[model samples]
Target chain A: MTVVTDGQERAGDVRLGRVGRGVRVAVALVGIGLLINGSVRASDDAWPFGPMSQYAMSVPDDASITYTRISAQTDAGTTVDVPLNIEGAGVARAEIEARTGEIVKDPSLLQQVADGWAKKHPDKPKYVKLELIRDTTQLVKGRVVGPPTPAVLATWEVRR
Target chain B: MSARTVATRAANWFTPAIAFARIAWLRTVLYLFVIVDMHAFVRDTRLKGEHPGLYQPLLLARMFDLPKPTVFNTTALYVVLIAACLVGASNYFPRIAGWIVAPAFTWWVLIGMSDGKVDHDHLALVIALWVLPTVKAGRRGRASYNDQARSESAGWVIRCVQICVIATYFLSAIAKLRSAGWALTWPGSAVLTWAIVRRPHPVGEWLLHHPWMLHVMQWVGITAEFLSPVILWLKGRWQLFGALFFLGFHAANTAILLIHFLPTVVCWLAFAPMERIVPWFQRRRASDSDAGEAEDQAEHGREAKEQAGA
Candidate 1:
């Protein structure tokens, strides 16, 4: 026998069921916990349970990304720009970004990359000349302010 | 208001609106989106860009020792995820289905996102997706307020999702400010500029010429993120405006930097008074039903009268 005073609350309220209520409270608490934890940790990797530190900082408009491009030559001897299909090799973007960083630090890896490609695809024709280039330009706006001044960092000859 | 009062109000605010119909629609759309996400865009195994050798498990995957999925495993996980999503959507063993989706979706997201960059946007949706099954069931056409059977659970789940949505922006603001330095003004601009260049939008080139615009975007973006939680405290039209503003923010983010936060947008649906639409639809249907019944009775009476006369 329940009497409504201020309010008895709704009957058959599924949220009140012990298990359902417990789950609801637990989930809400856990969500709060994660939100706090994520905020405090403040790293890119922590994710939903962590700080969403994506693009937290700014860089100069002139800040440049050292990108890798392979100019692969066809059987007809026409050279074309080839994107580094890192995912195709089962590598993550972070790993690729790291590798690019490495290339900038030590220019010698460019030859190793070219040779590895030739070994993997012995049948396919490769760029007669693979050049690791530093194309310094105003690349931020997606509109090149000037020609990509290709400063050849390193070069490797691909095996025919 | 004091902290306790605020907490009480939040609790009351989330007190389940009759959510059976509203939740049903959201759940179906969300689960289906997950299925499509796994199959098409983010398929880490057989479909799309898959690199088994390159599957570097992030902190959680490594900590939990989740399977380093091969082609077979990714495919298997995909099938299981699709089944769970379908079952959950259909409301057959919804808890079991939801349970399965949470982990499967986590796994799917981990494998897909880990390949390139791990995104925080889908994280909240994962939390919401799992908790949704804990909500009580309802008739598709019934009004949320009138439902006496298994009340409030639906609202609790929906409220949890709203909280998750808030966290996405609120926490993001905290993270940005915590590291607020020279980079906030500079690197932020550089990042967006680089992104536009990489993904060549029609307006990206136009935007590049105006470097000052980048700075304005940066400050405005962080300010919006910080203030987003205010919507929770606001009432009625203000809440609607707040919600629309955040949606616009996400839209701007996608258009400018090509940063997609689609799942977070889906979770935003929780903030909407979606239950009202269902009741409105039901009223129309009810009126149509009553009219048809009246017409039938009138036809019967006319026939009876004519027969008596004859």
Candidate 2:
């Protein structure tokens, strides 16, 4: 094996051919260009090359912080908060939040959440009704003013 | 300077020779992390398949006309990904394994992030997967962890990964600026308070009491992200410090927001000379074996003396 201790070209040192180098440079340029373009103009739909806009928007001090919660009335005649997590409902809160517009447009979209919960918890009491409740907390100077007010945005009666 | 001299300098900058062994080590780490990621962070990809009507394909997925995730297809993807990642991590058939992993994981992530929100944390990681396969591990392959031989191909790939990692940060700062109406409104705003209140974790709940500390943290975060490119230029201890600083940043985010940017964090290995780890371990092992041999020889000599006396 050819070993070179000095900072010089050696037989053992691997090098890319001219074509390989050209291809890599071109790829790098294009990738970087797309990233810049995505950040400047594209939305989340242009993902893998989209805006790094997580927490990019700032919330005003006096604005209300809204959270979409899933509350279900079970066959056991009790209402409980269905946690928007993979284990709880087989869906993330963010996923539900992302499609809030659609859910608001069509209340029937919530059947999926009920179906998911049923699939995950086969033995538990089936949900009779699933409500998308928005809990809005009023903030003053970055501090919570009072308890959040829960408003039901949409409701879906589960089909048994 | 002459145009020829400038062009040569630019070419040299793009292809600085880096140890091939670093690529071998990074490849193993990245591939293995894919398994951890699928099981934990993006576990919802499979669940999303069950509700295909909710599936909103990203631009890339839509452009390629990739099939929508189904129960069968997603399960198949999960099995295939796990198998491919294992083989790639093992350093066997790296090119083929890497090629499979690159597109598969990208598709997996596309499906996972197709909901309204797409995480910027994955930018570097996804790009790394694409570029890593371009370079081969030479004849030694998996056994080249201590190859010591430097290559321009390895350097080029490493550079590409590093750029993307920085872009995830630098562009994020720009995104913050753009979203805030080209003003520095982000650092001074109550975004953290809103997030903490929304999530309601213990540490974050405690942080809710102290508003000033959160404001300071926002300023520090944006400043670091804006200046993230300096890490690439930093050498030796400074570069290490820069990397560790970002890691600490992620740790704080986890502690407060419970958000783990592990994908981006794992790609930070690009900044390190990972190949040195193998040699370091080998040296320790050599010393350990030497000590063991000396002990054995001493025990044998003592036994020989005892027999002579007897």
Candidate 3:
């Protein structure tokens, strides 16, 4: 009876020891994992959870991106490339088609863009590049070199 | 211990001011760096381009058609506030610095919030800074980078900072869970496919043309993000695994995506118990810490002797 009791006690101790080792190993693994997880997710790059890619992801397809050139009326009309953002890809395609076609179909738009550019800069005439970053909105940038102050504009449809 | 005794002990030792300063210092530096970068980009880009309108810093503004200066002015105000906060972070003049910085930072962020893109990251920083001004960080200099003097709030301040740091992962995990498609599509493959279809980098575009690579990448991304939270919260070998997963994921993102903010992401590793990072640092620095400390103590002892002789 005494021998049997000693054997049983030894078995119980062994089981407890194994369980303790397993728990320790599991704990160590968890701590290491947490450190790693925190490091990668909290970076400051890619605009650090701001816009850039996020906005780019949201932009819809079928937006127009066009490129055009405008002529300044003041100081002997000089031709320059200008960019504009129209509503849709179809509008951009239509404008391009109209430019190549016999009659100037969208005279009103061309004149409006030209007038807007002319008003923004009084000192020198220049050209602008407008790209559609999103639907219904255009990004316009320009540079004017010397007199004759010509404005050339171009546009392109945004892609999603 | 009894709850009453515990409360009394805590009250006797607790130093709110020092705790506030430590977190304030950490946040102010981080916020300042981000704002400075934004300011530099805006200032430089505006000069080269005709309309300052081309660069929309955040998309929330565009959705509502908010005024142009709405974005610019708000960002500029943060830039100024961050500068003030940095001074506050230095542990100089707590009452004045704390009062001014807390409101200034909050107001600047409020303007950013007025638009749609109220980033959760900025929200975390605001809370950290706001709570700090109420603490005694200014008086004790416990939070100052150069000050080694332990303050009354040091332990509790550290504990709170640790909690805040840990919460970031918790929130990110919740966000991932909310975006169910991430798990369903698998982030690795989905992100790869998305990148390829949209603005494909040279390497990503090449890989996309091969469907096998795209499929593999997709699985990797999903597994990393989804399982990461488990490892992060556990804080041992698990934390190491989590870090490795993040490093791999971020490296892949950096390689493929034109997005440029990985450095700040890696800094979050500071929250890991120093026990783990210490061994790694020890190999590089060897006896540096002991030698430096010994030198400082020796210098202090000499100063004391000179005073005695005088």
Candidate 4:
């Protein structure tokens, strides 16, 4: 029943008692400190308090932009682009991009994408071989110069 | 200023009394939004569980030694979270439901964003969840929608949410500056152009032709974000304008880059006087009913006079 009217503390108005106020102040200070530390020093690993670095890096106008995509040779004897979406392969393009280094270091890791695809689409033509492809587009003065060049960074042949 | 005076001023600023009803309204909005968020936005948590090998736990998850998301655990978390959020939105058992939702959603978000890309938009949202449970309602464990009673606890929680929301913007500007090697090169760079070209919508594709306009937008965006804290001190219409401007900013980002920072956007309601919403609706309904009653009386009076004449 505690209420505050016009800056006057009326009886029964719920107040943050001395201890409550102190605790909150401490928590706020710590939280803000961590946020500052994260921005200054930490990486995405310190998430929920880490650097707010989405699109933080600047891309040069003339720089080449690379997009990673999965290309697969299906059992149907046709080469098709495997979508990097949850519905497509049970994984997102960002997920693949995040593990690009690991996948590049170990080409066999591409088998997981094949497994994911098989799990999602059991009736569809299974992937016979999976290639981790990078399509690089050259940009000049912030405009695309020409068609993108697709390069295969890693490949995995289905063992089945 | 004297040390005692400084302490008193700081205390007053942190614990300004605010209507408890605002918390009730905000809780409903935020908890309900969690359902929308889980299904539409971070729908990959369950799928990520299926591919546990891909789960690269973040720092907090790692520190907590949270088990790598499994089909069983993730599904369990999903069910628990939905149920808790629904109950929390109902305004019953506020603390219990709020506490359950706070950690579960945090863990859910942590799992969903375990990939190399952790979105900055979630910072304020996650903080709001944690702090909301600390504020208690009346003895019945619920704050009425029309409750005029103001509490310092409510103010503190709202302040925390507001601070985090502003921090999301202010810190992002700092991050941009840092990433540009502590130089002011970011605003002048073709970051927006690069993004547009990377994920080309029709509008963004057309924007690709106007690189100078994109550069100007980058400068304007960074400057506004850096100066975003001023919104906290702004009163009345200015504050609303600031909030609307950011919402517009989000709308523009969504239109161009297909990126919507809804999590942070929803938290902007903290800056609003949401306690008035329920009262406003109630008054309108009451007035409508009163007019109906007056019309009924007039009709009865006319019918009585006609009967007497007949």
Q: Fill in the DockQ of model 3.
A: 0.03
Candidate 1: where are CA atoms >4 Å away?
A1-23, A68-70, A83-95, A101-134, A138-145, A149-160, B1-18, B45-50, B136-150, B181-191, B285-310
For candidate 4 chain B, which ten residues in a row score worst on lDDT?
B301-310
lDDT of 1 at A19: 60
What lDDT tens digits, residue by residue, belong to model 1 across residues B251-298?
888888777788888888776655455344445555567777656545
TM-score of chain A of each: 0.51, 0.90, 0.23, 0.91
Task: Compose the digit string of candidate 3's lDDT tens values, residues A1-160.
Answer: 1111100121111121334333433433454354334333432121223211121121112222232333223333553434332311102222332342221432333334444445455556533423211112121221111212222233322111
Between the candidate structures 3 and 4, which one is better when assessed by TM-score? 4
Which regions of candidate 4 fall more than 4 Å away from where they truly are?
A1-12, B139-143, B289-310
Q: Write the per-residue lDDT of candidate 4 for residues B1-310, one digit (tens) a residue.
A: 6777667667656676777777887888899999899988888999878877777889889899999998999999999989999888877887898999999999999999997767878888888888888878753324456565667888889888999999999999999989988877888887887787668689998888888888888988899999999987777778889999999989988998898999999999988877666555555555567777556545434322221100
Instruction: Judge the docking of candidate 3 as incorrect, acceptable, medium or high.
Output: incorrect
What is the fnat score of candidate 3?
0.00
Model 2 Cα shift for residue B108 (angstroms): 0.9
For model 3, residues B1-310, the per-residue Cα lDDT tens digits are 6776654434322221122223444544544544454453222222212233222333333444544444465555555666665666455665466676655554443333332223334423443444445334433343243232233343233334433444444445444433443234223223444444334468866664565575576555545544544542444466676666666665776677644333235244333332222223333454455777556555533322221100
Task: Give the CAPRI rating of model 4.
Answer: acceptable
lDDT for residue B257 in candidate 2, whole number 0-100? 85
Model 2 off-target regions past 4 Å?
A: A1-11, B139-142, B288-310
Clashes in model 2: which pairs?
A: none
Q: Residue B252 deviation, candidate 4, in Å?
A: 0.6
Ranking by DockQ: 2, 4, 1, 3
Rank order (by lDDT, best first): 2, 4, 1, 3
